[model samples]
Target: MTETVAAIVAAHRAGTVSPAETVARSFARIRAHDDPAIFISLRDEKEAVAEAEALGARKDARHLPLLGVPVGVKDNIDALGLATTAACPAFSYMPSHDATAVARLRAAGAIVVGKTNLDQFATGLVGVRSPYGIPKNPLRGDLIPGGSSTGSGIAVSAGLVPLALGTDTAGSGRVPAMLNNIVGLKPSLGLISTAGLVPACRTLDCVSVFSLTVDDAMTALTAIAGPDGADPYSRNRPLSEMTPFPANLRLGVPRSGQLIFFGDKASEKAYGDTLKRWTALGATLVEFDLEPFYETARLLYEGPWVAERYLVIRNLLASSPEAIHPVTREIIIAGARLSAADTFAALYRLQALRKIAERAFAHIDAVVLPTAPTVYSTAQVLANPLELNSRLGTYTNFVNLLDLCGLALPAAMRPDGAPFGITLLAPAGHDAQLASIGRVFHADTKLPMGARGLPQAPLAPLSANVAAEEIAIAVVGAHLSGMALNGELKGFGGRLLEATSTAPDYRLYALETTPPKPGMLRVQAGSGSSIELEIWALPAAAFGKFVAAIPPPLSIGTIRLADGRGVKGFLVEAADINGARDISAFSGWRAFVAEAAAG
Candidate 1:
């Protein structure tokens, strides 16, 4: 009914579709489509219609975004009166509150359609882990529809809804998106609150969005993302300082040799073709080692983290294990054997891998890789459950574990007609950067929305997350670009925004030092001249680390900017300047150093 949320709102304003009519259309479509597997529990249409009517009765309701746009929910998320089955009967419980992400969507004027199917307790990517019949892949019914987010994907693909909420742990959000050829936005973990959703892997879970287009995904994310105090891992890293999608961008490709295809020739060829398309988009391609990433992924399953899953549902498994799907039961039961020491060992190795991962950002803005090595037929997935599920996550499992945010979008189709896709990933809290770049890639490819043949519409450029939760800190000399301590700022997640001059009340002094450094001192009012400096947005969580990296002579203090914005910038302690030489006349350290060499 609402192929376009914005369009629907416009139409409603133009008197083309009333809120009641929109609700009716959704009800008609659900019955007309008649796919029971698509919804595990249905919301009463009469009640939904009544709510829509009330929305229509409101004055100035036309101003509401996503007005009358009906959406579906994955069963694991809470919605009043809906049984939170999590695709396992034993895990079912009716919740009294909407999940944080769901509450945000509803507040945006989207109506709830129903709760869709998922892999039991959201533990697989193959969709078949559910005791409920696997939702048929709309693109290829015989193939697996993908999991955890399974029914959310199918609902969008089948045109039953324009958007849906799904939980992504490992590849729940992404795998289904790839298989169904829709957009799956796995936000930085905890960017959108997970408060009312059942936990899968608590620390790694993210409430994800599935939509027909990049713009819709962005709109949905902007509405949903914010700090939720209830979620321990929730964070607010305002995208305020991030550069918008660059006109000329650099994309990192996981080195080809490291890619896993699992013997699917068609998928391998399709991926190679996508890489060629990347070149055509004028993106610089750089290859990087992905072993450390894969090493981190293997630990998620090959280690004791499964214990976290068991810890969440130990009682259910103990009391009613038979109620879980056979495959899901098998998977969860494996967790009981791990000792606490195993969890500790995995944590240590993960930290070492984390250091290795930091190296990737130096080479490129985001990393692109196949979303899934290959997708399998429903029968194939069922026959070899664990193996097939693992293959589908070849590129995904490492993402959440490594604290990265990812977006999966459809790419080329395999020769046999199965969908193949790729995910663009960045470190945690970089969701906006990844989404901006993703919009470029999504629009560039010209793929259809869901399984419908409506050519993908252009995204109104992503509003940069410029309100990013980082403090704008300025560096005048030693900690400036290419300086000895530059990495310290970058390691703590500082991103340089611009190089410019400070206000007219600043002076630069060259300090005498073992490892040469310079200090910038703010002058008395109207006295010192403006000096050249660079501004970097330092993540608040990592500001302490950045500060610790600074030596004694330099300290952080307020400095007025040319724009009248007061920000954290470098300053020199009065006692450290006795032997220092003033270089304010040369403009900046680079200019001063260059002139000194000429002498």
Candidate 2:
């Protein structure tokens, strides 16, 4: 369908296609598809085409990044001139303006094709909890589409649109992506303004993007992410420029005891294969306990957070309880019985669990987990709605509670032909980092884009326009991605540049520190081996502060790269190496540590 935003923009710029033509093609596809369950309401073809024609007429159309792109907005978000029903006709409202995120897309020249259906009020992970018919899973009609962003996911997956907006309080954004075979990006909370979104656990809700590729999802994120004065929850975190993944990333996976597949052998094998793929790509997998994270996840539904969901429709639930879905009403009404003490007790427990979750990240660049433990057929989920819906949130509900960002990318297809996906998760503000790795990993799979039958395309090159005041630094040990001190680098807004080796003239030593660190020492020619290292770019202004924070025995100095370039990097003071263990045989800190653990 020529759905990618980049391809459409390039075609327009090359004079091969016009915005009006693209919009017309979008309408034609929607009409041909004829899925009444997909969209609650669609813009009239004439109105959308007229808007596209007007955009094409602008002298600066080329400056608009999303020119001619057609996108679907989840019905929960307000789009001007459309009724915002959130899949519940009883609660529909007409908004005079677009949501801030929607406004940004329009500003970038994206046409709002329609308001897609969702699980009513974003309540269920299963797609069937709505008055509107369930959005059919494009891959197999018998499978549940996955929700609450069901229609948005289906629209993009089926090629009716290349991009769609969704919201993730638990797994709304990611689960649907997995079932549909697409990319879903749940940006760090407060990164994307939620100003016009109807409340659904307001504090945890994030405006998410769904697209055919990691690059496309990222493009939409770039266009929409920012602070909004109107949204008090919005923060001022600027999006980091995209960079290539560092060579030696450490990804955390659940320990064998913690890996749950709900008896689905296909899903189990798919996840295992995906882990092997990550290791093959030069990433180290660290197994960690998932108990604390699971505890945090339990709080989302079992604790007082349900109170927030109830608050969204308190009056309606009281006045017309029968009007809502019976199960949804039961779930929300449970909040009314909770005491204030129960809320505080849950908050206290969450605080303790959050600390444990944060420690899990100290040794990994990100956590790689199955987006959902398993998939379900429509009949299976319908038969056991409550139990199955809770099960779907197994790997997703804890994300917002832990204040993490996640990227869900298609990894492989199961033996049975259903798609399998893995999510890369990191602490808040690491959205771009997840994208950097996800793009490369997704491309490696060579999977088609969703159900469109189009081969995955190469990612667009990262922007070369670096900020003038940036400095590149080479990190060798604890400061490397996914290591103990890695947060210090990320905290200062550092972005990984590359994973390469230093000139074959340095010896590495394990220093005497609490968690241990490595120091690189220059040696005589031909006597040393090329040690693995990673280069990171940080704002020049923050470099001094980072350097000054280094403890004694480790200092910043120039280190030569294999390609004959030099950069400021970590090195050991000559005197400090006296008591340190020479570990040059292992070549890198990760290898040495891994071997030590094995021994």
> Whose lDDT is greatest here?
2
Q: Each prediction's Cα lDDT score?
A: 0.82, 0.90
Clashing pairs in 2: none
Alpha-carbon RMSD, each predicted model: 12.3, 11.4
Clashes of 1: 10
Predicted candidate 1 versus true structure: per-residue lDDT over 376-475, tens digit per residue: 8988877889988888888999998888999998887666878889999988877777776777777888877777666765454222132347777888
- The C-alpha stretches of model 1 lying farther than 4 A from their native spots are 239-244, 461-599
- Candidate 1: give the clashing pairs: 237-469, 238-468, 238-469, 239-465, 239-466, 239-468, 240-465, 240-466, 240-467, 240-468
Residue 546: error of model 1 in Å? 36
